[model samples]
Target: MLLPKQMTRVLIVGSRNALKDTIEVLYQLEAAHLIDFSAEEEGFSLGAPLPESSVASQRLLKLRSLEKDMGIDDEDVSGQMETGQIEMDLASTIDGLEAEITGAIESKNKINLRINELEADKAVLQSFQALPLDLELYHDYDSLKVFTGKVRGDPSALVKAAAPQSEVFLSGNGDFAAVFVNTAQADEAQKALVQVGYTEVPAPAGPGSPQKHVAKIDEELEALRSSMKEAVDKLDELKDKHSTFVKAADEHLSIIVEKAETPLRIGTTEYTFAMDAWVPTSEMPKVEKAIAEKLGNRAHLESLEVMSRMEPHGHDEEGEEHAPAKVEEIPVKLENGKTAKKFEFMSGMLSTPKYREIDPTSAMMITLPIFFGLMVGDIGYGIPFMLLGLIGLKKCVSDEWKTISTLLFFGGIWATVFGVFLFGEAYGIHFAEQAHDLSWSSLLGVQLPHELVLGGFEIPLGIYSKLHSVKQILYMSVWIGIAHLFIGFCIGFYNKSIRYGMKHAIIEKISWLMILVGGALLLLFVVDFMILGKDVALTDIRMLVAAVLLVIGIGMAYKGEGSGAILELPGLMGNIISYTRLAAIGMSKAGLALAFNTIAFEVMWGHDFHVLGSNSGDIVMLIAALGIFLVGHLTIFILAIISAGLHSLRLHYVEFFMKFYEGGGVEFKPLKVIRKYTIEKNGVSE
Candidate 1:
């Protein structure tokens, strides 16, 4: 389809008591894209969550916390248990599981805390152990001043000279020192200690010898570590036992909570609730039938309006007049077949197509990969790309990977086709033979034909070489760009005509179309007269027509868009020139291939200046040539994906799409459930 699917506004009203049943039917139908409730509705309020939600929610929260504490993951679990089994076990098991998990975690925390304390105490004791003193002697000294810390050098002689009545102790390592001096001479002792570059560490308060204290703390740490290990093992056991059940029960309870809370988005009164939504026009009949059969008199559905592509009309009226209709943002639901759906995300990256306009995914899918192929143009790389894409499609699940795979698969097909017919090349070499260059015919030691005679006509395999046909390829790309933009402007004209009016559409888009056509004609004339070196007169028919068209087109554009149109004239010229990159990239890759081939075969072999020249006869030289050939080609292959892939995408996003696309419409998001770990069983479809 050219545009998104049409939508119809629906109002579903039901008694407050029947809200639950009505919600169940809607989920089962899976058609509505519900609008949120607003306070503007008189006598209506937002509905509260059901009573069952509270208990289930609380239990689910605790279960998640337990899952985290035990390091339980969905991947770690292996089997699915029955829903009945889960429901039966959840109530009784949750409370006991919570108690067990909480106790295990608390014990682990306590052990960790004690281990940290013991480790700190052991560190302090180790420093004191060097002094050969009891911990009590370092702290309990009223008539003495004790200086205990690590020192740069032993200061026994210095301390003795400063305080005559001082006692000094030195560690066997001589890094720890303790000086005790009479209270009257403490100031002198401190000054003497400062000369030895001492930094004080306060003596730890304890009653035992330092060596015994260290031993005691080490014993306690070992016991705490053992307890910590036991706690970890217990947590692991619980995870192994319950990860599957926990994930499944979480899915089950989550579905219940979500359905119960549906009324939160619907307006509610004391007696009834109102639900506003959009459903595809085609599905409206099915929805209506389901509601009538399931809900009966408990609910009422009113089809308010069937939306159209044309914008709504409103204007000022007399005395008893109505307010102008506001332009509602219709959500876009693209209609695409399986093949086209793969390209949807690429277009969606810019924004969803507006409901009233064309869905551009089809156009993008056709052109994007072709541009990629044109830039690459080689069967050697194309086959690998196709293989990569096929593998990715099979193994990868994400939308991004799948889209990339789609590009590679489609692009590879076009690349191979162009390589065989248009360029007759693989890995930048012509399939047959070319003057002063290598070819597969020479490499394989066989003759290859340049053309095949079919039904009395000669068909050339190689039409135009990428590096040798720069001007022709560049000219063709420019014309291709012009044709693509012409299509863009036409689509834009149609969109604008429906959205506003024909007059506005013609002035905005048709005017630009006229300018583009005139410029294209002028380019043809210029190429013929200048590049072809053909004589041409100023009064030539093509020149006269181009001048007139350009003047009229610019006049119309300036009238519609003011002076901004004039400023954009140069930009239009630049957009056309941008297409030259298609040929430029191909030429660059060909040049690289030629250089690698020369280095590996011609220069190294030094026998003939040809790409297919035999490698050096020496065994070591042959191996070196083969290594260079592999590594050099490998670099080009990897680079081809990046440069070719990104540049082709850029041409679409920046140049082609800018011609008409003004995306940013809201995407249609229907109320639905996506199941992962749990599946409905026993013929239940919910």
Candidate 2:
């Protein structure tokens, strides 16, 4: 459960004629992680793709183009399609869809282009309407040069000065001007118009009033818009008709293309091919039996080596060595229970664990939520968190949201437990009466029991308050840190022992274990001597043992890890101190909750409102106090999710995992097809 599934390297060799059959068998088994052929092997070359690849690739390209034109999203695929049905209809359906969709798209594009042109013409005609001129009257003059456009101010005076023979018609708005001059003085007249910030609006080529032309354009625009709507509806109808087929066909063709390309990863001669792959050791027997039964004497499976957690090592030699020239990495496939699998994403966010190391997902699953619950220990928030997480788990399909839901569900369980037993609080208020502070019992004017008895056994509801129990909580957090790191070091020791041998593991990991133990002892001594003011001296048994351990551990660490160990002495203490944040965050939340509770209770009590049936306080003041309480607690609830969630994750990643984890391994991915929109009633192609 703590390690990745063991892998065995296998070599499958076969006649070139059986290549396709071999590929199909391996994909069906879904156990092979194929290694790409290097092409350096003597007298061999990479295999060629099968003949069907070209035809399938062409069909897939056309199907994808149709999908794009139809604006098909994954959600648009409504139902599954049988592979046999898809195969029978794919060719004819693709041809029909291409032709029909092409026509509709072209028609729609033409209509849109026409509508844009008509809108532009209408704008120009409207501008000319302001000038009080007919479309033809502004143009088609032999001796006159007409300037018809808008101007910042009136250009009538300036135009008249430039050419006395020119006629300047200024609209009532004085912004639109139409100047007509003889061809000889056109240049001078234009210069005068430019002086007043003139911009020209070309007259449309037509023979009618400006308003009449604009009305005509509007009618044409309405017709084109109707046509566009028809075209869009036609495409939508076709998309609805053929969406399932297109999606299924795409999947089918993609699978074919992938299988065809598998040969490119293997070595081939004129008559024979060789493939290299890794399969889980436990599945080797099944794979071998399948190949022998399916392909007979044409293909042979040979087991090369069963990989071990202990790495292979050898001394340098002049003669031929036992190790291969190249050392291929054995891919890691983590083995975890369903519960632990949810936290795999968190570990993967760091990196996949190497095959030689223990998988950390199980460990993280056990601790991460406990840390979160410790930080956000409140029943008020915990119940709501559990509900939201349960809903998310049922609704969410993505890995990210599922992982978050898992954290919330598990963390909320622990939070509720701690809130009931350890803190005995709900939304920052104690259940029992407080000496000087407000509590549920005090506010309600009822006596709330401090403990509950079941079957003659007493269980204290509230053991300690978050704010008042800071010293103990902080002390407990430190020990939690110690125990967590101790687990990490033990795993590291085992990992190193397997990977490099017991001597190296003892020198590297056991040395740090000593230092951690020594520091824990010294912590106790310091608390007794300094905080409690005890008369303990330097000769105390705990102090002497701690000192000896520190000296020996430091010496061993220096010998194993060199000078870096000496420098890390203070850093170890800092790592332990970092766990105090667990206490600090809870206290901060409690402080906020306390302030809100105080304000709300003060408001209600000041107005003389004690219980629900009280006639002393006004209903308006009660409502106001309730509003403040709700909003304040809501804010704290949201902050709890972010602060508690993130700090808990950080504790695992930065402090705990740093002690043991060195992850960066390739994840095991086998060659197989995932059919979402399609199902095969008949078996896959041979």
Candidate 3:
């Protein structure tokens, strides 16, 4: 599908008493994209949220807080809980959980704080353990100053010299010392201690042997740790028991709050309410029937005009105060099929397509992988890539990974095809024997053919080599760029034609098409005259046609878009030249592969082993060569994903999409609930 699904404007008006029922019906249908009501409208004001919103929101908040306190993750949820069961137990369970979880968490925090305190005390006491002293003897001397800490060398002599009455005790290792001096001589003793690189370690407040105090602290620490383990286990048990109910109740309450808040987006009076929305044109009949059959005379649905691509100019000829269509606000619902839908994420990475324009996901689905495959053309790498991609697709649940896997799978398919037919190589080596380089045929002493004859039809296996056919590859890349851009211009032309009109489309888009065509023709002419050395006259038919097309196209483009058109001429040339990366990247990979193959094969066969079956290589050296080959190609394979993948995406995003896409439309999002943990039946979830 090229364009977004058609959306029709709709107005649903209902009695105030039926507002909740109407909201329920619309959500069940899941067909409406509601428009926010403006309070500036005459006699219509924004409605307040319904009665259920406040209570449900409060419960949801508390549940989330409990989940956070328990460190609950989605993986902790083991099974689903019925909505009816959750409703029955929600109030009591929340209260119980709040108390139990709070007590456990608080106990854990207290134990951790105490453990830290004990550890700090033990660290200080260990320093004193090396000294032969009781803890109380170092402090509480009225006329003496005590200095206890570590020192680089013995400070006993210096302290005794500075203060004659001072007593200095050094540990057996001479790393710890305590100095006691008369208060008058404390300054002198401190200076002597500083000279020996002293750093203070204040004795912790206590009594008794330092060893005894340390032993007591360690014992206390063990008890606290055991208590901590119990607290953690209790919290874990609570999490295991209630994780399912917490998650399901969260979902159930969230749905209620969302539905209850619907009135805030609508307009209401004391007796009635009105809501504006957009519905797909195909679903209008179903929606109208549902509202009539369910809500009866209490509610009514009105079908407004179907939105069109044409921009609003002025009132129509017979207009009688009709409102102009809000084209910008018409949400775009892309119409891609299942196969093309995988690329919707890639297109959405840019922006949603406007309702007026084509959805480019389908187009990108075709070309992006082709470009990637062309850049990474190697069967050896392609097969592994396909396998990795397939595994990722099967296992990955995220959109980002799924999209990447899709690219790798599809791109690998094309890479295999190109490697087999276009390049006829695997890991940069030809299947057939090469005149100058090594090949599988040369290495294995077997002859491989360049073509396969099937049912009397000749199918060439090997065509152009990446390293040897630079000119031809480059030429082909340029033409590929031209054709890709040609498709872009065609899409652009159609987009403009629908959005504005045919004349505007011609001036805006078809003019660029002409310029592109003229440039392509000129490229052919230049190739013939200069590279092929063909003598061409100044008034040759190709040259004349090219000149006429360029002039007329430029004139029209300038008239439509002014001086910008002239500025973009050189840019268009740059865009075309950019595609040459398709060839350049492949050649770079080929060159790297060649270097690696040469080194590896050289290690195995020696320097002069160029001819096929000329030498018998050593098994050890051959094994080593295989190791190098494996590591080298693995590196190239990783680089290929980055370089080739990014370049291909860039070519589309920058060059191809720039030709046509103007993507800033809002995505269509209907009011719907996505249930994962619970199932709904019998008017209640199970």
Candidate 4:
């Protein structure tokens, strides 16, 4: 739809609390549509009403606010925006829902508090059970005796040793060696026993040393554990009772704390608590309807006012109605009211040809095929290209590249057709066989006219005569170039006609046509023939005259413009010559193919034949030949593709675009809820 090309005002509502949320929702919606939005607060006012400045900006601001207010980490928010569905009015909805969440959080907080208390009590109980033991076992002996594996005899040990045989007594601190044992074996053992002694000396308080305190410590520890466990059990019960409160508190604080700090407000409008956002222009209506349905009377929606390069008051006249400007719409035509459905069909195929305004999609569609055919001009290469392109189309999910894939598919088809033509297959020409068999008669339905030999080798005239000549292919290349250049001129003329008027179109068309025709003829007839010692045919002389006429026409057209036009003739001439590269590349492709085949077969195969015996050498020759053929041809094919694709793109972008395209048009962005992998049914995340 056409609308005035002017800046539109946007109004947002709600306090800072809502502002963050509102801004977030709108930002995501706009981004999904590829719209660039920047925030501007200088002219914004909360009291006075104004139009929404930019839906994209509003959405983005809201997204930022949502991230900050909700305590959502910045990284998390960015990841969400990247992976989540972008939605219109999602910011406001998130804000409102978050507002309600505060209440729920309050209740939850109470429950969490109770649970914390219970955990603390349980920790206390566990601490009591880990008390250290009170009793200590003590013994004293000489260091030398212990190290030497000799036990010092003490009174307690003597009593234990004699208890099994007879009643015996020992003093607590008395040396064992000073006491004599009343035993029959004592006399015999005494002669061999060394004086080693130890003593268990009783304290002044006797056997009551530290025992009462140890018993008391054990009793205290047991009591502490019982008390702590009882307390933990009571705390757990209390937590269960208040669990809901804790959950509510947590939710409440998350939403309300942030909202209280930053108030949200509508921008210079009475439409408080709600705002509009920009989305992809294509999805504008759907988003608007969704917002209306979700918010009912609370939401206000408006159509997008897209910006344009054309000035509204170009020629001011009294009471003149302004031209309605809208976002640049794709140029499409429909048949049978079916809308042509190019959206799906040309998804990947619709490439942004380097310079779109000059050549446009139409020119690219034509030129790309020529380049592809030239590069992949063999049936074998063409088959791979076609298969690869088809596979890409089938497997690729990005809609952005679908159009490009489609173009390649068609390009492959053209390559195959051209390949067949170049090989003379339709005419039954088999140069490959004739190369081996000099006796072969007819080739491509033509009889041998003369003996065709090259480099002192006798070659079959039937196939070699026709195949060796590149003159026909070269001529075709020149003709194709002429047609292509003419087409470019027509496109330029059409563009000028649409923007300016019929007069300008005619003048420009005539001027360009004359320039192209004259330049091409000069190259093909005068320069090519005269400088190369190639005789000009009678028809070529006629063409030279036409070329002169074209030059004169160009001069006449630019006569009134300025002397600068004359000065620019050299540059124009250069551009015309640039078209010649197309033909050059085509010829190069054919030449390279021939050279690769020739050298690979001759050198590699010839060496094998000279060195090895016939039977064994034949196998080696076949393998080497096949290897060289495949590798050499493959390398040539890759180079050709790169050269053709890049050079063709350059021609379109630089040569063609220089004539017309002005590409700084702002893309249309609408506000909408976008989801990845799946569509959102409720228009909101649960």
Candidate 5:
């Protein structure tokens, strides 16, 4: 399974008419997964010069073609229902319906036509409503003919009058008028006007009247209103019918398009069809079974065969011979219930070292939990993390996210283990009560105390003894740093040995291992010699030899071409020492919690306010103490998590990865309809 990894290149082919369909399907597939693929423009030749166009346009064209093939019409029920049915169809017959429906819906002219018709009818109705009524047509002579009633004033005097003859005309604005026969009749008109609340006008003597044309125009306007209403109703009915037919047509069109375009092929190999795609690698029997059940074997068949390698070429005598490009191939191996290649992530990154190189989904899985656990490193926090990760793993729709969830599941376990260690309860050893008592002996032989000498007298002080000992905390910080560095070395060795061969692995990968071990021994031996005033005993020869071996190994495995310089060695040593920050921050979080609790109880309670002394002050003091404890601890907890998480990532990225990781491996993305934040049964699309 050891071979040089090669970049993947895909070739897609179809009819000229199907090009747009192919682009659309490819786009959908790309959106659905995290896999990276790009089409090669040099593979095809343009017959004529044309402006570049949007893929959406091509998709639209393909959809139109499919609709035409299916005989879809907006006003035709048969076609509209056919398209709608095809869209809703769960069977294999409806495969590629989305593209078809999208195209058909876009290409439809009926909806636009209906909209225009409605707009025209509305305009006509509005125009009729806005027409101004004729005024000043009610002269004395014209009024006398229209009304058979007496005027409200004397025959010689002008007075307002009302027209009571027609429902189509209004009496206001002098559009119509009433006529009186004599002065005696005028008084009677006045009585009638008072009852109706109107003032009459005097009649004029004239045969020619302008109100005649006004009446005629009113009659025509009434007819126009009736016609406009009928037209509006018909337009609404047409729109409803058009919408129904368009929907039906879209369904039928989807089916026709799917049948027209065959599954993509590379030479003699046919790509497995699923959700507008031809998937590669069908080793999973379940996938094949699914394909068979959905699409009959005759239409969608699966065949297994190894792809052929490109041939090499020889050059002519005149110049150097041209050689066929050799395609580097990676041998896949099965591990952890999945197929994987060594250095896959690294190789992929190198191949496409751009924005697309990084997989955010995978990064989330690997980084988030590591960050969370480092922040809340307690059994209590781990439980919640484990549960959350499990839920994400089970329900995540993106395959990439599912992979991340899996990482969180494992990280939670490690965090839980580390928390147990911090609790001082390893192997049933409990230090709950004695945690603050520095006089307590070491658990598992790890020193817990520091010493102080005053006035020529020696005094022993423990790191965990005081409620808040900055010096003690610093000592614990150093120890944590030491442990973190050691862990990094181990990870480095493991990663390199697996990824690269032992030849390269030993010199580059094992450098950290030697540095950590050798440095620890040297520090411990020097400390022992200085503190106890003892010479290096013969009995400790083995440790001395081990230290010597580590130093020699580090020198041999040195990676840089720089000459061995004393200055460089110190820098390298410092880098190794930097790993201790992981443990330092973790311990700092715990230490801060203890310090806050102590301050809250001592400072807050020590204050005696006689004015507020009825034990009420004590209760308030207690509440304040608890508040300070929570707030202080919570702040420290957050800082510690940030420190641990960042340092851990730094150790992995810079220190550990420096030894071996060359992450650039392309991720495997399959063609499928994936729901975001939800689950689906049998891989159905929404």
Candidate 6:
């Protein structure tokens, strides 16, 4: 069905004791999409989580913390364990894992802290190593004030002049200087040091030379680094040993927790509980039977209403958009097969189709690639595209790559077909001979036929050339746009008819269809008069038909949509013209290909372009030609993916889809547990 899957509202009510069995049954069925309960009804309150929730949640928190410490991740998990095994070993495993992880992580943190301190100490010691001073000598001077620092130049002479009684010790390199000045002249000594660009360095209270202190720190740093590695290795060992069990236990507990928490979405009275859900309409009988067989007399299943696509009219008397706020929207699950499923992302990216409307994914799938192939109608790039798409489909797992790969694979098929039959060229050169033209036949010094002769029948190898057939291709593209938009209006009419009524549908959509048809006819008359130099009078039959249709369509649109309809006439004309880009982009790509081919073969390799004169070729010319050819086509190939592919998608998004698609619908999400590492052999898949 092109429509979304049908849904039915269901009410499941039972005594409090049956809640657990009912939840288990629902999980096993995997058919219910539960709606969270609101405490609106009197005497009905939101239910609490089951008794087991607290224990499971606490364990889950601890496991997650351990997971972070051990760097355990989804990718690291390699194997699975049975639920029974996880249940048996979970308690002991968590206890032991906690101790090992806590010890290793604590040790690793301490080593890391010590390493940082040692590194800081080493940086300080490096500065003082230049000066030949013991650490204790620079500090604790009572009779004399000492200034020890680095200076831009030798400050010994400056210090001697500033304080006559001062003794200065300059390093051999002369960049480091230490001055001892008497108390009375300390202020004068400091001023002299500042004039020489001296920056102060404070001395530490250690009892040895800076070199010995740095060596001692280095030994400690090396020891800490070794310990850090050992700590990391211990954590890694723990991760490897417990990886499978932890993953399995997490999955197992998650399933338990999810089941326990189901009650939180149910409304409960003093003695009874009620749960609301949406079940697939087709599965109602099976669900009913399952509930009867499993819960028996303890619980009862009540079928509410079976949902339909015929929603009520738009706005009510109050002019509010949505009049029925209390009505629950039936979730939309698009019933697409495997091929159409691939295009769902492209369509869904815009909006999920409403249950009442048609799913547009199938439509997008048909045209998106066709538009792409039409733009990249060349054999040279098409074959490689197919190969790339195939490789990507096999190798890539993401939704994005799969969609792109689908486009390339299907678009390549049409590209190959069009390149062979329509363009009859590869890399912008013709396969056969033409007057005053370079072709494969001319370049290789062999004869090539213009058409295939099979059973005395002739089939042309080429139809309309992209570069030479501008008028024809442009005219064709405009009509393609018209046909595409015509389909859009038809879909709009159907959607409006279903949603509003036939009268509103006719007024809104069919009027636009009439205008579009009139414009198409008027275009034919205008093209003949202006471009073909033919006599096309206002009284001509085509002109009369166009005028009559346009007037009636305009009147209808004005009555239905007011002055906006009058304004949209020129907009419609522009919309039709927008499709000319399809032909324009193709011509641009062909121009690029021709330019590259000329530069590589005619200029670089000195091969005859046939329109020009012939020339001789050599080994060096052949290599250069190959290089230019490879480089030039590679650029074109990448541009084709971006240009041809994107323009096609844009044409659909901006021009085609806007005509009919109004998306925004709730997607169907069913209630089910997904197990990653644990398998339940006893469970059955719905």
What clash count goes with each model? 0, 0, 0, 86, 39, 0
Q: Assess each prediction's global lDDT (C-alpha) against the native.
A: 0.84, 0.88, 0.89, 0.46, 0.42, 0.84
Candidate 5 lDDT for residue 184: 37
What tens-digit string does per-residue lDDT give for candidate 4 at 1-686?
11211233233334433344444455444422322222244554443211233443444454444343344421321112211223443445545544544433444455456555545544333222222211121123222111111225533344335432233222233322222333554443333234343332222111332445445445655665565565555444434432332223223232233232222223433334434333434545555565455445444555546433233333222212256474224322111112222222331133322111332544456576666665455555666667766887888867545544554566677766665555432112233434442221332234633444679976442221224445554556556656766776776666555544556556656676777777666666665667577777757775867767677767655752346556766766666557667656655665666666666555444534322233343667768877877887778657755776567667766665555444433333333333322332334454
Between the candidate structures 4 and 6, which one is better when assessed by lDDT?
6
**Cα lDDT over the full model 6:** 0.84
**Clashing pairs for predicted structure model 3, backbone only:** none
Compute the lDDT of residue 151 as modeled in candidate 1.
87
* CA RMSD of all predictions: 3.7, 3.3, 3.5, 17.8, 16.1, 3.0
**Residues 1-686, candidate 3, lDDT per residue (tens digit)?**
68999999999998999999999999999999999998877888899899989999999999999988987788988777676777778889888888998899999999999999999989889889988899999889899999999999999888889888899988888888989899999999999999999999997777899999999999999999999999999999999988888888888889889999999999999999999999999899999999999999999999987998775553222212147564337899999898689889999999999888999999999999999999999998888888988998899999999999989999999999999889989999998888887788887778888887899997877699999999999999999999999999999999887877787788878889999999999999999899889998878888999999999999988878778889999999999999999999999999999988888878877886686445668799989989989999999999999999899999999999999998999999998888876655433533
Model 6, TM vs. native: 0.93
Query: Ten residues in a row with the worst lDDT in model 4?
Result: 142-151
lDDT comparing candidate 3 with the true structure: 0.89
Model 2 regions more than 4 Å off: 313-326, 607-616, 683-686
TM-score against native, each model: 0.92, 0.95, 0.93, 0.49, 0.45, 0.93
Q: Candidate 2 local accuracy as lDDT?
A: 0.88
**Of 1 and 4, which scores higher on lDDT?**
1
Q: Better model by TM-score, 2 or 6?
A: 2
In candidate 5, stretches whose alpha carbon ends up further than 4 angstroms from where it belongs are: 1-84, 87-421, 424-502, 510-516, 530-534, 537-547, 558-572, 602-604, 607-623, 670-686
Candidate 1 error regions (>4 Å): 81-84, 191-197, 205-209, 313-327, 452-459, 501-503, 611-617, 681-686
lDDT of 5 by residue, 1-686 (tens): 12222223233334443343443454344421212222232343222111222332344455455445444454444321322343344233223454444444443434445545555544333322222332243333433333222222332222343323322223333323344334434455444445544543333333333254434445555665565555555444443434343343333333334323322322121222222222334343443454345433333333323332221243232222255384322222212113222123322432421111122223323443454454345554455456656897779866555544554455566556544544432111223334433212332235443344679875533223222433443445445455545554454444444433354345654655566666666666765677557787745764686578677766655442224423445765666556445445555565665566457646454533111222343567778877886677567644544565456555555653443334344333433333221222223343
Best by TM-score: 2
Give per-residue CA lDDT, model 1, range 29-140, as digits (tens): 8888888887787899999987788888998898888888888876887766556667778899989888998998999898998888889878877888988779899776
- Clashing pairs for predicted structure model 6, backbone only: none
Model 2 quality (TM-score): 0.95
Report the C-alpha displacement of residue 196, candidate 3, in angstroms: 4.2
